[model samples]
Target: MDSDTFVYTTYIRTTPEELWKALTDPGLTRRYWGVAFETDWSPGAPMVWEEGGRRTADPGQVVLAAEPGRLLSYTWHTFTPAWADAVGLGHEVYEGLAAEPRSRVDFAIEPSGDTVRLTVTHGGLAPDGTIKELIGEGWPAIVSSLKSLLETGEELPEPPR
Candidate 1:
Protein backbone atom coordinates (compact mmCIF):
# COMPACT_ATOMS: atom_id res chain seq x y z
CA MET A 1 0.00 0.00 0.00
CA ASP A 2 1.32 3.45 -0.78
CA SER A 3 1.37 5.10 2.67
CA ASP A 4 -0.38 8.27 1.54
CA THR A 5 -2.34 7.22 -1.52
CA PHE A 6 -4.65 4.46 -2.66
CA VAL A 7 -6.02 4.19 -6.17
CA TYR A 8 -8.52 2.10 -8.09
CA THR A 9 -9.36 2.34 -11.76
CA THR A 10 -12.07 0.70 -13.82
CA TYR A 11 -13.62 0.96 -17.23
CA ILE A 12 -17.34 1.04 -17.75
CA ARG A 13 -19.11 0.44 -21.02
CA THR A 14 -21.10 3.63 -20.82
CA THR A 15 -21.02 7.25 -21.79
CA PRO A 16 -19.20 9.73 -19.57
CA GLU A 17 -22.44 11.58 -18.93
CA GLU A 18 -24.16 8.45 -17.67
CA LEU A 19 -21.25 7.58 -15.40
CA TRP A 20 -21.15 11.11 -14.07
CA LYS A 21 -24.85 11.00 -13.29
CA ALA A 22 -24.44 7.69 -11.52
CA LEU A 23 -21.79 9.19 -9.29
CA THR A 24 -23.54 12.47 -8.54
CA ASP A 25 -27.25 11.80 -8.63
CA PRO A 26 -28.47 10.80 -5.20
CA GLY A 27 -31.31 8.63 -6.47
CA LEU A 28 -29.01 6.71 -8.77
CA THR A 29 -26.26 6.43 -6.16
CA ARG A 30 -28.63 5.01 -3.57
CA ARG A 31 -29.15 1.95 -5.77
CA TYR A 32 -25.45 1.14 -5.98
CA TRP A 33 -23.56 2.86 -3.15
CA GLY A 34 -26.14 2.50 -0.39
CA VAL A 35 -25.23 6.08 0.41
CA ALA A 36 -26.19 9.15 -1.55
CA PHE A 37 -24.48 12.50 -1.59
CA GLU A 38 -26.48 15.70 -1.37
CA THR A 39 -24.68 18.69 -2.80
CA ASP A 40 -24.87 21.22 -5.53
CA TRP A 41 -21.62 19.64 -6.80
CA SER A 42 -19.88 22.92 -7.42
CA PRO A 43 -16.32 23.24 -6.21
CA GLY A 44 -16.16 23.99 -2.49
CA ALA A 45 -19.78 22.94 -2.01
CA PRO A 46 -20.80 21.33 1.24
CA MET A 47 -21.92 17.70 1.03
CA VAL A 48 -24.36 15.79 3.09
CA TRP A 49 -24.06 12.01 3.25
CA GLU A 50 -27.11 9.90 3.90
CA GLU A 51 -27.58 6.20 4.56
CA GLY A 52 -29.34 3.77 6.86
CA GLY A 53 -31.46 6.39 8.58
CA ARG A 54 -28.52 8.64 9.35
CA ARG A 55 -27.38 11.86 7.75
CA THR A 56 -23.87 13.22 8.20
CA ALA A 57 -22.54 16.61 7.23
CA ASP A 58 -19.17 16.55 8.91
CA PRO A 59 -17.29 19.81 8.58
CA GLY A 60 -14.35 17.89 7.20
CA GLN A 61 -16.28 16.60 4.22
CA VAL A 62 -16.96 18.85 1.25
CA VAL A 63 -16.72 18.95 -2.48
CA LEU A 64 -13.18 19.80 -3.48
CA ALA A 65 -13.84 19.90 -7.20
CA ALA A 66 -16.56 19.16 -9.69
CA GLU A 67 -16.56 19.10 -13.47
CA PRO A 68 -19.55 17.56 -15.13
CA GLY A 69 -18.89 14.27 -16.91
CA ARG A 70 -15.18 14.54 -16.22
CA LEU A 71 -14.12 14.82 -12.59
CA LEU A 72 -15.31 15.10 -9.03
CA SER A 73 -13.42 15.21 -5.76
CA TYR A 74 -14.42 15.29 -2.13
CA THR A 75 -13.06 14.83 1.33
CA TRP A 76 -13.69 11.49 2.99
CA HIS A 77 -16.53 11.05 5.41
CA THR A 78 -16.03 11.93 9.05
CA PHE A 79 -16.75 9.36 11.73
CA THR A 80 -19.57 11.15 13.45
CA PRO A 81 -21.24 9.43 16.39
CA ALA A 82 -24.23 8.49 14.30
CA TRP A 83 -22.06 7.15 11.51
CA ALA A 84 -19.98 5.17 13.99
CA ASP A 85 -23.10 3.59 15.44
CA ALA A 86 -24.46 2.83 11.99
CA VAL A 87 -21.23 1.10 11.08
CA GLY A 88 -20.92 -0.62 14.45
CA LEU A 89 -17.64 1.08 15.38
CA GLY A 90 -17.25 1.99 19.01
CA HIS A 91 -16.18 5.41 20.13
CA GLU A 92 -12.56 4.58 20.90
CA VAL A 93 -11.75 2.93 17.57
CA TYR A 94 -13.77 5.47 15.66
CA GLU A 95 -12.10 8.35 17.44
CA GLY A 96 -8.65 6.95 16.90
CA LEU A 97 -9.25 6.57 13.18
CA ALA A 98 -11.19 9.78 12.80
CA ALA A 99 -8.57 11.88 14.59
CA GLU A 100 -6.12 11.24 11.79
CA PRO A 101 -6.05 13.57 8.81
CA ARG A 102 -9.17 13.17 6.75
CA SER A 103 -8.59 11.58 3.36
CA ARG A 104 -9.81 12.87 -0.02
CA VAL A 105 -11.06 10.93 -3.02
CA ASP A 106 -10.83 12.07 -6.61
CA PHE A 107 -12.95 10.59 -9.34
CA ALA A 108 -11.60 11.07 -12.82
CA ILE A 109 -13.69 10.21 -15.84
CA GLU A 110 -12.31 9.89 -19.34
CA PRO A 111 -13.95 8.84 -22.53
CA SER A 112 -12.25 6.06 -24.49
CA GLY A 113 -13.94 5.04 -27.72
CA ASP A 114 -17.28 3.69 -26.50
CA THR A 115 -16.54 3.53 -22.79
CA VAL A 116 -15.56 5.71 -19.89
CA ARG A 117 -12.45 5.16 -17.77
CA LEU A 118 -13.01 5.89 -14.14
CA THR A 119 -10.12 6.34 -11.76
CA VAL A 120 -10.48 6.78 -8.05
CA THR A 121 -7.52 8.15 -6.14
CA HIS A 122 -7.78 8.38 -2.40
CA GLY A 123 -5.11 10.49 -0.73
CA GLY A 124 -3.96 11.61 2.73
CA LEU A 125 -4.54 8.34 4.53
CA ALA A 126 -3.25 7.96 8.06
CA PRO A 127 0.18 6.39 8.51
CA ASP A 128 -1.23 3.16 9.89
CA GLY A 129 -4.26 3.81 7.63
CA THR A 130 -6.97 1.58 8.95
CA ILE A 131 -9.36 3.26 6.52
CA LYS A 132 -7.20 2.23 3.58
CA GLU A 133 -8.00 -1.42 4.06
CA LEU A 134 -11.70 -0.74 4.28
CA ILE A 135 -11.56 1.46 1.20
CA GLY A 136 -9.49 -1.10 -0.65
CA GLU A 137 -12.16 -3.69 -0.16
CA GLY A 138 -15.05 -1.33 -0.64
CA TRP A 139 -14.08 0.60 -3.78
CA PRO A 140 -14.01 -2.37 -6.13
CA ALA A 141 -17.38 -3.55 -4.98
CA ILE A 142 -18.86 -0.11 -5.27
CA VAL A 143 -17.47 0.51 -8.72
CA SER A 144 -18.49 -2.90 -9.92
CA SER A 145 -21.99 -2.25 -8.69
CA LEU A 146 -22.00 1.02 -10.55
CA LYS A 147 -20.93 -0.66 -13.74
CA SER A 148 -23.54 -3.36 -13.43
CA LEU A 149 -26.21 -0.81 -12.82
CA LEU A 150 -25.25 1.20 -15.83
CA GLU A 151 -24.93 -1.71 -18.23
CA THR A 152 -27.44 -4.27 -17.09
CA GLY A 153 -29.97 -2.22 -15.18
CA GLU A 154 -29.09 -4.31 -12.15
CA GLU A 155 -26.77 -3.64 -9.25
CA LEU A 156 -24.18 -6.01 -7.87
CA PRO A 157 -24.91 -7.64 -4.54
CA GLU A 158 -24.15 -5.56 -1.49
CA PRO A 159 -20.46 -5.29 -0.68
CA PRO A 160 -19.33 -7.62 2.05
CA ARG A 161 -18.67 -6.01 5.39
Candidate 2:
Protein backbone atom coordinates (compact mmCIF):
# COMPACT_ATOMS: atom_id res chain seq x y z
CA MET A 1 0.00 0.00 0.00
CA ASP A 2 3.00 2.31 0.06
CA SER A 3 2.89 4.79 -2.78
CA ASP A 4 6.66 4.65 -3.16
CA THR A 5 6.74 0.91 -3.65
CA PHE A 6 5.19 -1.67 -5.95
CA VAL A 7 4.68 -5.31 -5.09
CA TYR A 8 3.31 -8.24 -7.05
CA THR A 9 2.90 -11.87 -6.06
CA THR A 10 1.94 -14.93 -8.05
CA TYR A 11 1.97 -18.69 -7.63
CA ILE A 12 3.56 -20.80 -10.33
CA ARG A 13 3.43 -24.55 -10.81
CA THR A 14 7.18 -25.04 -10.67
CA THR A 15 10.03 -25.67 -8.30
CA PRO A 16 11.95 -22.85 -6.67
CA GLU A 17 15.19 -23.79 -8.39
CA GLU A 18 13.58 -23.76 -11.79
CA LEU A 19 11.88 -20.47 -11.03
CA TRP A 20 15.19 -19.00 -9.97
CA LYS A 21 16.81 -20.09 -13.20
CA ALA A 22 14.04 -18.52 -15.22
CA LEU A 23 14.57 -15.27 -13.39
CA THR A 24 18.34 -15.23 -13.78
CA ASP A 25 19.03 -16.97 -17.06
CA PRO A 26 19.50 -14.49 -19.90
CA GLY A 27 17.90 -16.71 -22.48
CA LEU A 28 14.86 -17.34 -20.31
CA THR A 29 14.53 -13.70 -19.27
CA ARG A 30 14.85 -12.49 -22.87
CA ARG A 31 12.25 -14.99 -24.00
CA TYR A 32 9.75 -13.79 -21.43
CA TRP A 33 10.69 -10.17 -20.80
CA GLY A 34 12.87 -9.12 -23.74
CA VAL A 35 15.56 -8.09 -21.27
CA ALA A 36 18.73 -10.07 -20.64
CA PHE A 37 21.06 -9.26 -17.78
CA GLU A 38 24.76 -9.97 -17.90
CA THR A 39 26.07 -10.58 -14.41
CA ASP A 40 27.70 -13.17 -12.23
CA TRP A 41 24.65 -12.77 -9.90
CA SER A 42 26.77 -12.72 -6.80
CA PRO A 43 26.26 -10.07 -4.17
CA GLY A 44 27.98 -6.83 -5.22
CA ALA A 45 28.56 -8.09 -8.75
CA PRO A 46 28.01 -5.51 -11.46
CA MET A 47 25.19 -6.05 -13.95
CA VAL A 48 24.80 -5.03 -17.55
CA TRP A 49 21.36 -4.89 -19.06
CA GLU A 50 20.64 -5.88 -22.61
CA GLU A 51 17.34 -4.95 -24.14
CA GLY A 52 16.27 -4.12 -27.68
CA GLY A 53 19.85 -4.70 -28.78
CA ARG A 54 21.10 -1.97 -26.46
CA ARG A 55 23.39 -2.52 -23.50
CA THR A 56 23.22 -0.35 -20.40
CA ALA A 57 25.87 -0.65 -17.75
CA ASP A 58 26.85 1.35 -14.71
CA PRO A 59 28.97 0.81 -11.64
CA GLY A 60 26.01 1.40 -9.37
CA GLN A 61 23.91 -1.21 -11.09
CA VAL A 62 25.11 -4.04 -8.95
CA VAL A 63 23.40 -7.00 -7.38
CA LEU A 64 22.34 -6.28 -3.82
CA ALA A 65 21.56 -9.85 -2.87
CA ALA A 66 21.85 -13.20 -4.60
CA GLU A 67 20.60 -16.21 -2.67
CA PRO A 68 19.84 -18.60 -5.46
CA GLY A 69 16.33 -20.08 -5.36
CA ARG A 70 15.45 -17.85 -2.42
CA LEU A 71 16.05 -14.16 -3.08
CA LEU A 72 17.44 -11.81 -5.72
CA SER A 73 17.73 -8.05 -5.47
CA TYR A 74 19.47 -5.39 -7.53
CA THR A 75 19.55 -1.71 -8.17
CA TRP A 76 17.68 -0.77 -11.32
CA HIS A 77 19.58 0.21 -14.43
CA THR A 78 20.47 3.81 -15.19
CA PHE A 79 18.18 5.53 -17.64
CA THR A 80 20.26 6.47 -20.64
CA PRO A 81 19.28 8.37 -23.74
CA ALA A 82 20.06 5.38 -25.94
CA TRP A 83 17.89 3.12 -23.82
CA ALA A 84 15.09 5.64 -23.80
CA ASP A 85 15.34 5.95 -27.56
CA ALA A 86 15.37 2.20 -28.02
CA VAL A 87 12.24 1.96 -25.88
CA GLY A 88 10.57 4.85 -27.73
CA LEU A 89 10.42 7.16 -24.77
CA GLY A 90 10.10 10.86 -25.49
CA HIS A 91 12.81 13.30 -24.56
CA GLU A 92 10.77 14.95 -21.81
CA VAL A 93 9.74 11.64 -20.36
CA TYR A 94 13.31 10.42 -20.47
CA GLU A 95 14.52 13.55 -18.72
CA GLY A 96 11.95 13.06 -16.00
CA LEU A 97 13.05 9.46 -15.47
CA ALA A 98 16.71 10.42 -15.46
CA ALA A 99 16.05 13.01 -12.80
CA GLU A 100 14.40 10.57 -10.42
CA PRO A 101 16.34 8.57 -7.88
CA ARG A 102 17.21 5.06 -8.95
CA SER A 103 15.03 2.25 -7.65
CA ARG A 104 15.71 -1.36 -6.70
CA VAL A 105 13.72 -4.54 -7.25
CA ASP A 106 13.64 -7.66 -5.11
CA PHE A 107 12.34 -11.07 -6.03
CA ALA A 108 11.48 -13.54 -3.27
CA ILE A 109 10.87 -17.13 -4.29
CA GLU A 110 9.38 -19.61 -1.81
CA PRO A 111 8.25 -23.19 -2.13
CA SER A 112 4.54 -23.72 -1.77
CA GLY A 113 3.42 -27.31 -2.00
CA ASP A 114 3.45 -28.09 -5.74
CA THR A 115 4.03 -24.49 -6.75
CA VAL A 116 6.40 -21.70 -5.93
CA ARG A 117 5.34 -18.33 -4.66
CA LEU A 118 7.02 -15.45 -6.47
CA THR A 119 6.89 -12.00 -4.96
CA VAL A 120 8.44 -9.03 -6.71
CA THR A 121 9.00 -5.84 -4.75
CA HIS A 122 10.20 -2.68 -6.44
CA GLY A 123 11.18 0.00 -3.96
CA GLY A 124 12.87 3.41 -3.63
CA LEU A 125 10.54 5.08 -6.05
CA ALA A 126 9.23 8.60 -5.60
CA PRO A 127 5.58 8.63 -4.65
CA ASP A 128 3.38 8.79 -7.76
CA GLY A 129 6.46 9.41 -9.87
CA THR A 130 6.81 8.69 -13.57
CA ILE A 131 8.91 5.56 -13.09
CA LYS A 132 6.54 4.37 -10.43
CA GLU A 133 3.56 4.87 -12.72
CA LEU A 134 5.27 3.13 -15.59
CA ILE A 135 6.23 0.09 -13.51
CA GLY A 136 2.81 -0.06 -11.97
CA GLU A 137 1.62 -1.18 -15.38
CA GLY A 138 4.69 -3.21 -16.27
CA TRP A 139 5.27 -5.62 -13.35
CA PRO A 140 1.97 -7.46 -13.58
CA ALA A 141 2.31 -8.14 -17.28
CA ILE A 142 5.92 -9.20 -16.88
CA VAL A 143 5.09 -11.49 -13.96
CA SER A 144 2.13 -12.97 -15.82
CA SER A 145 4.29 -13.68 -18.80
CA LEU A 146 6.84 -15.31 -16.54
CA LYS A 147 4.14 -17.50 -15.02
CA SER A 148 2.81 -18.53 -18.42
CA LEU A 149 6.26 -19.42 -19.70
CA LEU A 150 7.03 -21.67 -16.74
CA GLU A 151 3.61 -23.28 -16.79
CA THR A 152 3.11 -23.70 -20.54
CA GLY A 153 6.61 -23.41 -21.98
CA GLU A 154 5.52 -20.31 -23.86
CA GLU A 155 5.29 -16.67 -22.92
CA LEU A 156 2.38 -14.37 -23.57
CA PRO A 157 2.40 -12.14 -26.63
CA GLU A 158 4.75 -9.18 -26.64
CA PRO A 159 3.30 -6.27 -24.75
CA PRO A 160 2.88 -2.89 -26.46
CA ARG A 161 5.65 -0.44 -25.71
Clashing pairs in 2: none
RMSD of each: 1.3, 1.0
Query: Which model scores highest in TM-score?
Result: 2
Candidate 2: tens digits of C-alpha lDDT, residues 66-143? 999999999999999998888889999999999999999999999999999999999999886899988998999999
Off by over 4 Å in 1: none
Q: Write the per-residue lDDT of candidate 1 for residues 31-100, one digit (tens) a residue.
A: 9999999889988888999998688887778999999999999999877877888788888878877777
TM-scores of the models, in the order given: 0.94, 0.97
lDDT of 2 at 43: 96
* TM accuracy, model 1: 0.94
Candidate number achieving the greatest lDDT relative to the actual structure: 2
Relative to the true structure, how large is the alpha-carbon lDDT of every model?
0.89, 0.95
